[model samples]
Structure formats: C-alpha cells, structure tokens
Target: MERLQKVIAQAGIASRRKAEELIQQGSVKVNGKVVKELGTKVTRNDRIEVDGIQIEKEEPVYFMLYKPTGVISSVKDEKGRKAVTDFFPMVKERIFPIGRLDYDTSGLLLLTNDGEFANLLMHPRNEIEKVYIAKVKGIIDNEKVRKLQRGVILEDGKTAPAKVKVLGSDRKKETALVEITIHEGRNRQVRRMFEAVGCKVTKLKRERYAFLGLGALRPGDGRALTPHEVKQLRAFASATK
Candidate 1:
C-alpha cells in the first residue's frame, strides 16, 4: 500500500503537495468514497478518482525545455496565451513544470510526470542551486554585489546569501549583466533582488538548475533527459533530502 497522495502523484495527476491539496479539497475519491485524509493509503487494486476522472499510472518522463519569453510555464492557459506544454505536442504523459518562471522570463525549465521528484527539487529545504543571468537598468558596483552576496531584505523576508558577480557593464547604456546563484524559488526573486538594490531587472533568464544547463538549445526547444542525467539528479536530490 502507498499513501493516496503518493499514488496520485505517481499517476501524473499532480505533484504530491498538490495531490494533498486535492484530497483536502474533497476532489479525491477511492473506491467511490471521498478520502480527505492525507494519511490515507491504498493498494494497487483500489480504484481512485480525481475530479470525477479515474487515475492511471504513466511511465515517468523528464524533459528540459528552453522556454521563450512571453510563454507561461503551465499546462494550459485560460487567457489563450501560449503555454509551455504547447511545445510538447507529442508527449503523452501529463507532465507539468517543476516550478514556474515568469511570463516574461525565459530559459531552462524542467517538466516531468514524476511528482515525488518535483517535490524533492521544489522543497525549500533541498536548496537546489539555480543560476540566473540578469540585465539590470543600472551598472552594479562591487558594493552592491557584496550586498547581494550578504543577503538583502525583501517584503517576504531576508533572502539567503547568494553567489553574485558582475559579468559586464555598458556605461553608455547604463546597464549591467549580473550572474546570481540562489537556491530559493520565490516569485520573481531575481528581479526583486535587483529592485531591492535599486536596480531594475530589464531582462532575466535562468541559465542553470542544479548541475543542468541549457546547452545549445534555442528558444522553444525541448528534449528528454538522458538516463544518466536523471540518475545524477535523483542522487543529488537524495543527498539534499
């Protein structure tokens, strides 16, 4: 037997956290009975339904996408905007983005049907490192870079110390390219961090996640992860866990 939420997650219905939310919202039923308890467990023979649809386990698949700016990182968009999943027209699994990038931010994004894996990577305690390249409105000096390295206060809270460096600056344009490495996944964090330092992020792109980087992929391109890559990611996640 496995936890109901785990089963739902493994079935590609949602992440384990989202699966728990569904259960608490009374959207999950097992054997025709609504099961709201997070601890509920079930056997393989049991019939599980979510939102009136039966669940079926799917072979887990992992993908790396070069999400372009102006695309939402979601399976669907109610506003008729282009979504990340629209790029995967041939994929059969019900994959979803592990985390989201802003509609205007672009770069490497991961998608998968494995909810447990997603939870492990997305969980704050894991501290999976993400690297971003930002083009900001003003030239960043060594002092501002030091401040970011030491951590800065924001509305949510003080951010953790980050690895920051100024790649280059254009005095004529009054802009700079800064690279920052952080583990937290706060909403629009990179942009907000710059804003806190009196710099506005004019453009942002995630260049790396954990040990993975976007290699030779252009915008709107995607490919399945290699077996070795997946193994390495799982091992890293396990170590962090």
Candidate 2:
C-alpha cells in the first residue's frame, strides 16, 4: 500500500504536493468513494480516480532540457505561450519540469514524470545547488559582492548566502558577468539579489543544477537522464535528507 497522493503523483497526474491539493479539493476518489484525507493509503488492487477519470501509471521518464529564454517552464501555458513541454513532442509520458525557470531566463532544467523525485529535489532541506550567470548593468564592486555572499535581505526575508564570482566586465558597456550559486529556488532570486545590491540584471542563464550542466545541447534541446545519473541524483538527495 502507498499514500494516495504518492500514488497519484507516481501516476503522472500531478506532483505529490499538487495531488494533496486535488485531494483536499474533493477531486480525488478511490474505488468510487471520494477520499479527502491526506493520510489515506491505497493498494494496487484499488481503483484511483482524479477529476472523475481513472489514473494510469506510466513508466517514469526523466529528461534534462536546455531551456531557452522566452519559453515558460510549465507543462502548459494558459496564454498559449511556448512551454518547456512543447519541446518534448515525442514523449508520451506526462512529464513536468522538476522546478521552473523564469520565462525570460534560460538554462539547464529537468523534467520528469516522477513526481516523488521532483518533490525530493525541490524540497528546501535537500539544498541542491543551482548556478547562474548574470549580466548586470554595472561592475559589481567587492563590497556589493560581499553583501550578496553574506546574504541580502529581501521583502520575503533574508536570502541564504550565495557563491558570487565576477566572471568579467566590459568597461565600455558598463556590464559585468556575475556568476551566482544558490540553493534556494526563490522567484527571480538571482535578479532580485542583484537588485537588492543596486545592480540590475540585464540577462541571466542558469549554467548548472547540482552536478548537471547543459553540455553541448543547444537551447530548446533535451536528452534523457541516464540510469546512472538518475541513481546518482536520488542517492545525493537521500543523503542530504
């Protein structure tokens, strides 16, 4: 037996967190009976339906996408904008991005039908590092860099310490390439961090997620995660837990 939300998530219907929302919203039924309790568990022999439709378990598929700017990092965009899933036209599984990238920021992103895996990696306790390269409006002085390294205060709260490195700068353009490594997945975190220090991010791209990078793949291209890579990711996440 497994938790109902876990089962729903593994079926590629939604992330475990989203499945809980579905359950609470009275959209989930098991064996023809609405089951709203989050702790409810079900056996393989039981029938699970979400939104009045029975769920089918799909073989989990993992993919790494070289997400491009101007694409939304969602399964589908309500406004008909291009989404990360649009690149996987040949994939039949209901895969979703593990987390997300800003619509205007591009780089390495992971998509998968394994919601449990997604939850594990997105959980803040796991502290998975993500690295970003940002082109800012001005050359960041040592003091501003130190402030970011020490953690800056944002409206939401104080940000975690980030690894900041000034890759280089163009004096004529007054633009500097700053690399930032952070574990927290706050909304527009890199850009916000620079803004908190009086610098504006003109362009940004994520270069790495933990140990994964966008090898030679061009923007909008993707590849499957090798079995070994999946194992390593799971092991690392579990270890951090």
Per-candidate local distance difference test: 0.92, 0.92
Q: Which stretches of candidate 2 lie over 4 Å from their true place?
A: 1-5, 12-30, 33-46, 50-53
- Write down the worst ten-residue block by lDDT for model 2: 8-17
Q: Tell me the tens digit of each residue's lDDT in model 1 across 1-241.
A: 8899998987767778899999999999999999999999999889999999999877789999999999999999999999999999999988899899999999999999887888888888889999999999987988899989999999999999999989999989999999999999999998999999999998999999999999999999999999899898888877886
Tens-digit lDDT track of model 2 for 122-150: 99999999999999997699999999999
Candidate 1, poorest ten consecutive residues by summed lDDT: 9-18
Q: List the residue pairs that clash in candidate 1.
A: none
Candidate 1 clash figure, as a count? 0
**CA lDDT of 173 in candidate 2?**
84
